[model samples]
Target chain A: MVAENKGIEPGGGIVLDGISHAYSGRKALDNVSLTVPRGESMALLGPNGAGKSTLLNILCGLIRPDAGRAIVAGVDVSKHSSEARQNIGVVFQDDSLDDRLSAWENLEFHGLVYGMDKPSRARRIDEVLALVELSEWAENPVRTFSGGMKRRLEIARALMHEPRILILDEPTVGLDAQTRAKIWSYLNQQRRERDLSVFVTTHYIEEAESCEAICVIDHGKVQVQGPPADLKARYGTSLIRCLPRSPEVRQKLLEKYPEAQRLSGDRLGIVVRDQAMIDAFLSEFGSSLKEILIDEPSLETVFLAITGREMRERDEVNSKARGKRNKRI
Target chain B: MSKLTILGRGIYAIWLREIMRSFRDRGQLIGGVSRPIIWLLILGIGLNPYFRGEIYGEVRFVIPFTYLQFLFPAVIVLNIMYTSILFAVSMIWDREFGFLREVLVSPLPKWAILFGKILGGSTVATMHGFLVLILARFADVTLGWDQVAWALVLMFLLSFGLTSFGVILAARVRSFEGFGVFSNTIILPLYFLSSSVFPLDPSLTRTQTAATYPEWLAMLVQINPITYAVDALRGALIGFNQFDPWIGPSIIGAGAVLFFFIALVDFKRQ
Candidate 1:
């Protein structure tokens, strides 16, 4: 089977079948399964210890799953990691560039590790540096680069060998909003131009919303998976919020809309199915309310609706697990 | 390309990068070469009068060879030992900065990566040993070209063994501070226990054997592989005898292969 595809096909993608993993007698990934289609973007949304890292380790062939198989770009990662890894490129959450090396040398080293010859390495180094808009700084030490430029250079280094799938772990975690947007724009451009499959994990709901498919994981298990629009439509389409004028008005609003929740600081939040429902709600309680705000449901609301827990709350629980795991490792 | 070519290039690439890093850090390069030179100047000249004449004459049957001649190869061994070990410490830095992740995730095998680091470090340390050998002329030692060539080969073996030992220790260390403490605790004792600064089983008189030496110190010297390295180098640079000349190269040669395999196993586990 491995010999049949000595080289990965450009259209090949990733498949994780019942992948399970444990660290120090505690389950880190519990039968977690996911897929990224050829030439598509998929977000594995998880809080810190939500088994996202373990899953990624399995996919990269760094850690073997206890009870499942991971196939990357038509090769089984466990059985043939070198071949599988050849088809995959990774950008870790940690800073991976050697600070002492120039940007060109860093990429050149990566190219050589992947067995690219001198001419190809040179050509691809130039091409990748240009792609990330870092051609001007190619000769400068990576230590001298700004955080955003370093991140861009890391992306360039990951793409030096032109792998079929790109897996990024929280690629924009510490970046400012503008830099994050720039990174996304560059990633999207590359995904389109090269027809590359991107499997990215991020805590940012909005970032996941931009992907073609989303998988929400918590407590080492995937809570939900679907398109952002479909999940939002099924869970919540619109959010209706209002601040009441009086105690009697607040009581009446709660009695009329049973699902309405009291938000922080004297305001109520309710999930409405459509604009018509929001309009009907306003018509009925318009005068009783001091203010009303109605808008389309954000991914956060969808996440909250599906998981029945806030992202921050999940993060707190996962952080404790991660702390213990970190100490053990 | 054949698999052999790919593996060769991978190892070469890793080695090339480390060399580039070592050269670019000017303080590191200068420091690696200068520490031994300082020892050769200060300690060699300082201790010359005390044990100059009769000490080595009993061991080698040679007359008028000063303590500096005896100390030169020891200092060269010292240079090779510390430089290669410190070079292996970069593995911890690589982990902390996440550059190790790139290497770990590459198509290349883990053993190949470890081999590249070992080869790079040993070669650099060996070259640094050569640089320090330039000061040998000032020590009143004759520079036979054959002796110089022999010294380099012995230096290469010694450095390879030391670097592989360093890699074994550094492979699992996660932090620079941890590695620093571990290296200090291990390397200092390894150097002191070896004959890098003092002769192991130095013959005191014509008929006396190494049994006349202190029991515990003799045992330590016998067990220390680095003692063989220094002894072998002492033979290559000057006519000397403490043990059979082949003993040093053989111990270091076997030790290099053993430590390299151990490091490879440790790295693969990681």
Candidate 2:
């Protein structure tokens, strides 16, 4: 047994070793092992059914892994979940705030649950309100707030205890691009200012790019793990798109650039290993092409390449499977 | 500072929040109080002539005050029991709304959450019970200071036991519909079978009727913690037979503690 610390220690991190979990013979997480170093922001990028939420729940001490051990802030979460949870903060995938309560009341009640004294709770509530940029609406009922506002409040609630390790499960799902970007900026700022270790699960490939490191998981297992840029450079190739003005023109272009992969609608995608290929393709077919696009391989492409399906499609399939499983039970 | 103090504070806050929310819900507060008031008035008046008789050379009093004096105390226990069950149903809503997860994940001990909810529901039950008693005073039932104090104590103990039982049921229940079925299957039967409405005379055929069901039901009533509570209230408000004076209240207290620990264990499993 490790001794409990009275205060935050430097270089505190999370380590999960050989963690496996099953629900009614269906494996949710399969021997997943990962580490998040102190002050490192890690993104868990996965298609649906990749066990991201399961892993987050384990780290947060909400669910016990059926096999192996998970340590958070030097405490084994499964064995000492209450004590372990004291050192960690989590924002669940679903909205966990009391909608009937005002924003300030919600924070106050959460602080009380964490055993904060009145003075400390009041001060911390003010600080967190400012941190989430909701000081103006702190007294307003949470039900009246927009989705983005509610999500921000949930983040603020998690930060009330000043946890050393923060775990967020799909924090920005179903949000507008602008709101997502704002939340991303706030998280980045917090990371730099507090040097807090953050573990996040996100389906959005663009959000994954902002993390210091990324772990791509598929089918309840980690497929690849590394820095985002490094993973993209390793697994991703640049793609060139070409669009012909007419059907006859498109057929001719397709014959000419037989290497190009046809995307969903009227777009032709071609892998460009070097700038010479782009120049040659443009010079040869520049007259017939109505539009052209060039981009690096995205997180979506990396997921498709590794998982053999798009993230959205995988989510639909997983939901159907879950519905069937629920019916059987 | 210590785990105990942390738990204490958590329970206090949760209890306070529940009270505040219950008061805010106008329909719940009004319905909780009014249901018992209506029962006391309508049933007490309607059954007054029916209970007029002499049994075992003792004169039978009318229903409202005479019968109500006996029934009112039981109604107080019933009020607490019913309200606690209703509060348990609200737990289903809490589960669906994601609030239960928040409470479970708090740093406080899991038992604290269970006790907090039990305390909250019991407090509401006690309040409603008191309202019925005060309204009974207007219905011509006289009570001294000692009787009122004793009645309050018994009401508190009864609420604690019933609330603990409700907590145990709530933890086991999965859905609102399931809780509804349980409420119908358990609450009504417990109310009718117990010596709530009429006196328990071993010679009465009604007593025989209670005996015909099962040993468990008879034993439950014989040991029915609520039976002692009703007896204590009857002895205080109306002139009724009191048996095993100290043993009854003591047993009810013991039962409350037992049920509370059982509910706590169930909460930990959840």
Q: Residue A220 in candidate 2 has what lDDT?
A: 83
DockQ each: 0.75, 0.63
lDDT by residue (B95-194, candidate 2, tens digit) is: 7888888877777777788778878888888898887888766556787888888878877777888888877788888888888888878877777666
Clashes of 1: 0
Q: Weakest 10 consecutive residues, lDDT, candidate 1 chain A?
A: A320-329
Task: Identify the candidate with maximal TM-score.
Answer: 1
List residue ranges in candidate 1 displaced over 4 A.
A2-11, A237-295, A312-329, B53-64, B172-174, B200-213
Each candidate structure's count of clashing pairs = 0, 1
lDDT value, candidate 1, whole model: 0.80
Query: Under CAPRI classification, how is model 2 graded?
Result: medium
Model 1, span B38-106: residue lDDT tens = 888888889877653345455442223678887888888888877888876777778777888999899
